[model samples]
Target chain A: MGPLIPYDIIPFEWSSIIAIIIGLCFGFILEASGFSSSRKLAGVFYGYDFAVFKVFFTAAIVSLIGLLYMDYLGHIDISMLYIHPTYLWGAIIGGAIMGIGFIAGGFCPGTSLSAVAIGKIDAIINVLGIMVGVFIFSELYPLFEPIYNGYFYGNITLEDSLGINPYWFVFILTIVAIIMFAVTDMIRKRVKKVFY
Target chain B: MVNRKLVKFLSLRYKILAFIFIVLAGGLVLLPKHEKQEGISPEKLLANTINPERYISTDALAEKMINQDPSLLLIDVRNESDYKKYTLTNAINIPLKNILDEESEPYLNQDAYDVILFSNDHFHADQAWILCTRLGYKNLHVLNGGINSWYNTIINPKMPTEDMAHTEFELYAFRKAASMYFGVAYPEKVKKATVIKPVTKPSITAAPKKVIVKKKKKKLPIEGGC
Candidate 1:
């Protein structure tokens, strides 16, 4: 269970510092890659840009494949990795709300934080919106409990539930990502240009 | 052939594509994450299940019981009814059903104890070890040969001599019964009769696996209990 901090290899005190450093790098890469702009983030919804999709999908696939490879190499056990529990309704409802949040605020949590680092006023607004969202969620936690804790299937990964080799899954995901990247590029070429 | 078209040229979103190589590069760094190679196999587990860590041993465990370390969370992976008969001092109850529930209040926000699981044979403890390890719980250890080895090594070091006193043998038998019940008894069977006189052999004996499980180097007093 690589939460390296828990193993005591790295002390927990460093987690925040580590998080900030990771965030800084994340923000730097994200903003430098043009995620700071609201229009860019919203392009996915309006069929103008797929950069957000490409970056996120690529990262997920890469990490999945890399972690699985590490498992195969025996440097780590794949079984120990954390899996977000599947909440069927949460996935659908929470995802829809997030999509709305994405379209309205034009900054998801990470991008907004990165944009805030660079001192974007709109990004600051988006962040405040997020805090309000967080507060609302907490206040209404009881009402949201049905989706939040309803469909717990236990800590499960794709490999654990599907009974497929992680390597195979990662390989498939990588191939799918590559195909999406290529397809998206083609689609972007044809879409009506929306200059921001 | 033509100057960049407006759609391809105008949007900053295409910049996200530039980092495709970066993601692949990140994978390179993650591949060698763990310094130690995991050599997990059923055979290795079968071979090394009873093989005790140098820090853990029968004498050390027995000594720990005597001193009574509060930090020690000695778990008996056996069933419940056996536990009721008698258990070591200050030991808590958690059978194999949710053995990993040391912090099992998963649904609720609660702190679970640091639990150690033991069984009659090292096999049970070892099995629990595998299960917990897979589940990613930290700080788990096997109690060598659960209660069986404890009876063989720590509780009784000498063969039952003809002159072995009845009361001493009774004490050992009582402790043995406690160990078995606490360490392995599941399904909650009532305590067995306190038959203490010299008997033909111990009811629970760990053979072939005996030497490795119970016969490892004894733990010195320097390191605290198992």
Candidate 2:
């Protein structure tokens, strides 16, 4: 009911304002929880500290729970949100590349931007790398057109592809994440800390 | 002074929290459903095209024509020659070529009419609908199956190509080599819809510009339907 944009229920103008507010909240939360550090973000690969794991898992779980609650409570419709298309080959290849990039640069796009806000030099380099990568992708789009357009399942959401209710999926995913969170906390205690 | 006020505010924290909770609950009650409303429903239609109101069934439009709803405006967004030949009854010819050409503003400005547009296919109608709607025209609608559906439902009413048209068997086809050379689709059992209307041919003032649009609307030779 409450998707402010696209419906034109709320004026199209509120979209940018909402995005800015959401981004600010997101940035503030990440910065508050010490996600601005690259070494901190990189610890998922190195097994030094699992603060990243705890924080990320908690946030994901929180959002999932919140979305489910919102859907149930009828503040927002779950069916309306844009689901990330499952490009099987693209998701596999692109995710692998992003995982590698995450480990190497120690910052994903969101964290990199937040870090840049605070004048972190390494994050600036990481952000530049991301920009260059995006530029290269755009320029080379013609060459990659075959791959990009090869297998389209037509904007299918996870529910459409998997034949499951989104609420149930979110609930199950929440359970799994909670388990993973508990398991990682144990693992984090075991890994010897290297203070950055 | 500020510390005492701050303490008082802190002491009244439950009241503020209760206020927020009540506001959220009130909003949940007040905000309208995003899906049920019209306008392509940019979010949930993408989310679920099965959403009935958001879906513009071309088959349904053909049915509406057969039933003769005079209020429905069918816009032919194909070029002039394509439009001049065999547009449906009461359908307006606003070709895609001159759609944005400023002179065609009256057709685009028909917000009162439930305008369903089409061409050789849905591509042109969809473009027109998208263009008009994106420019803030709410009444402009898409003819989903386009003229192909006009052929299927109004012309012949056959089984669909995708999954065997769920409707009952009402027609068959002439698979002969002679039919192919002529480029006639839905050849048999398809009569001009307006032909049955006993044409004393009173200068059709019902038509806007004295254009004899139905002249090219003739049926081919006999066969069953598909």
Candidate 3:
């Protein structure tokens, strides 16, 4: 049942139903984990709390390991998965914009939707702000088209780009993540609590 | 001194996570490294050729020629005698053994042309395809069922049976037009001897071991906004 869509085990007609179920689960999990709290989300930047960093990093690493293990065991064909193509300069610029937005808004796109479900007026405003940003980008698409489309990198994987063995890269990343977790805890203890 | 106290009070969850990471890292280190396979393997190349999309039907080839599709390039992989006796219009003869020769390199490797290789049946065309795939050639396709199929389908087309589908009749009509365009005189009504079997009909056909028939589905809407 793993990678059900790609294997065509789940028919194409079931995609929308599957999507809604997945979205519901995601929103439930996020809300249950206290991610809907803007203060808790923003605490990562200020080093007041490290829950966001710890949870996200753990989730990423766990999924990475799980997928690698599944692929190694031949349960799923990883090559058949659609990888989002990379555009070098476009990625850098887009990431920079996103980072700034994340820090200022205190609610990511997903979390903001969760927040809105709880009737938070601020979350509604945040969602509207995101919509406005999207509208502006679409309107001015021609102007930004060159930058958006430049530096095509053909959906290259991290291992391909860095020229390192995948397992070695995973090992290195796990070590780095552990170090970051330990460091973030230290910073959180040192910083004065904001109690928000 | 403070860091030592914090370490002493480290939570059980953190300890377990740290253990998992360390174990995974150690396991990764111990695993034997194997070089990744770079290009298409012979088995995979053969398997890919089983896909019908890799074959341009003889009728389609005739239609393309009729329309003067500049991108289409036909290569006859039979001997010079067979090629001279009868070959598709504007086809170049490059014998199966000579496919890798220096003179044939440019004809085989161009991106602009949809290079179609053919033989009497699919045998030599498949061999040519295998050679091309192994050597990392792009845009090379086998003419399905090859020249024999070409003659049966285009040089003389058969009218559809009484109970046949409308689409089959439409295809027969198109094949008739193609036959006429290629200057091959075909009968209005096909005799039992002249009637050709469907392309996938097994007795005379050197068919693949497995043929996966993919069902057609309506195109789904583009998914994901964020």
Candidate 4:
């Protein structure tokens, strides 16, 4: 009775339309929240504005809580949701590269698109850079295959990997996030303010 | 004054974080530990389908078929060739791979019939049963020894020993008559060699094969996701 598209409760034809609607709404929300500005995004690195951290972390926690509660109430079967299959080194190395890229470029893929929607020339260039990176990686896949396919752990949730109860993990995460938020605020005060 | 200023400096963002933290902490303390068992755990599905009630014995299926029970639906899960060679009367051929197809869903997922799935042995039928059970389909039963048992008991029943109970003999006699009704020559008649030669050969021999071939062509096992 849940996961409508996967369960065929909603016809397959509507999937593209639904995806477009969701994507548009997501972009609109991001743009409205001033994510189009690279300075605001870079603030997370520089310890100036923490909008990036606050927004992203809040969204994650909110969705985490919503999904868990929805699953508990039997409105949706949480188990059916796809977990990204973990390739340990690939994730660590790829994430490190992305983190470096994020600090340097001040735009991740999604925020770059939102910036592009508002006609930011830098974001347009950033998107081109991402495309080129993707193209280069695809062309050189054989060279990177070892790292890409190495340490193949199946799709697993935090609880599965850590052997902790999901509720306790969520509670711990929430506390950690709260402490980070406080720390970020203090750091933002100490850092010299840069107006964007 | 510094403490009040500090409190005032904690903006809407911090307020939201504080609120979420308190809620999460409360939830963790009060709520029972939610075990995050990912994706309809295979172990649980195995346990669910392992129930004895999940199987319909060959004898019970034979009785239901003999009665021409409208609520009984037999599903042959063998390959097309095997199903064409021999299958139960009125059984729908939903080969193992096609059991989850949209076409077969109407048959397997419905409660209107006591849907009994069978293959050559219990192997394929149990596989189908596990699949249907995992997908949360109810009212499905596996044919306990599948068509192999059906043939052994119903199509060519063994006569009871002399010392067997009257009820056992009665059941065997009923099975013998059912075998005759289905046009299977008894072992005793086959041993006589010439006794059932005329009775066993006819258009009745070609009818099942033809029907199965036609059904196989119509239900050409569509590829479906598990």
Predictions ranked by lDDT, top down?
A: 4, 3, 2, 1
Interface RMSD of 3: 1.5
On a 0 to 100 scale, what is the lDDT of residue B67 in model 3?
Answer: 91
- Candidate 3 lDDT over B39-123, as tens digits, reads 4555767677666676888877888899999999899999999999999899999999899999999999789999999999988
RMSD, candidate 4, Å: 14.3
- Among all windows of ten consecutive residues in candidate 4 chain A, which has the lowest summed lDDT? A71-80
Tens digit of lDDT per residue, candidate 2, span A23-106? 999998888888999998998877777777866765665676566567765666666676766556777678898999999999
Clashing pairs in 1: B78-B184, B79-B185, B79-B186, B81-B188, B101-B104
DockQ of 3: 0.39
CAPRI verdict (incorrect, acceptable, medium, high) for model 3: acceptable
lDDT of each: 0.65, 0.66, 0.81, 0.81
Tens-place lDDT per residue, model 4, B88-142, is 8988899999988999998888778888889999999999988888877878888
| Candidate 4 chain B: worst-modelled 10 consecutive residues by lDDT | B217-226
The number of the candidate with the highest TM-score is 3
DockQ, prediction 4: 0.23
Q: Please, what are the lDDT tens digits per residue for candidate 1 over residues B68-156? A: 65546777667788677755556555666766565542311223434456676767667767765544345566676676666676554
Q: What is the TM-score (0 to 1) of chain A in model 3? A: 0.95
- Model 2 docking tier (incorrect/acceptable/medium/high): incorrect
TM-score of chain A by itself in each prediction: 0.89, 0.87, 0.95, 0.95
| Residue pairs of candidate 2 with colliding backbone atoms | B160-B165, B171-B225, B172-B225
Interface RMSD for each of the candidates? 5.9, 9.5, 1.5, 2.2
RMSD of 2: 18.3
Model 4, position A18, has a per-residue lDDT of 98
TM-score of 1: 0.54
Candidate 1, residues A93-189, lDDT tens digits: the string is: 9899998999998988888988898899999998998999899999999999987989878877766788985544555566567777778888888
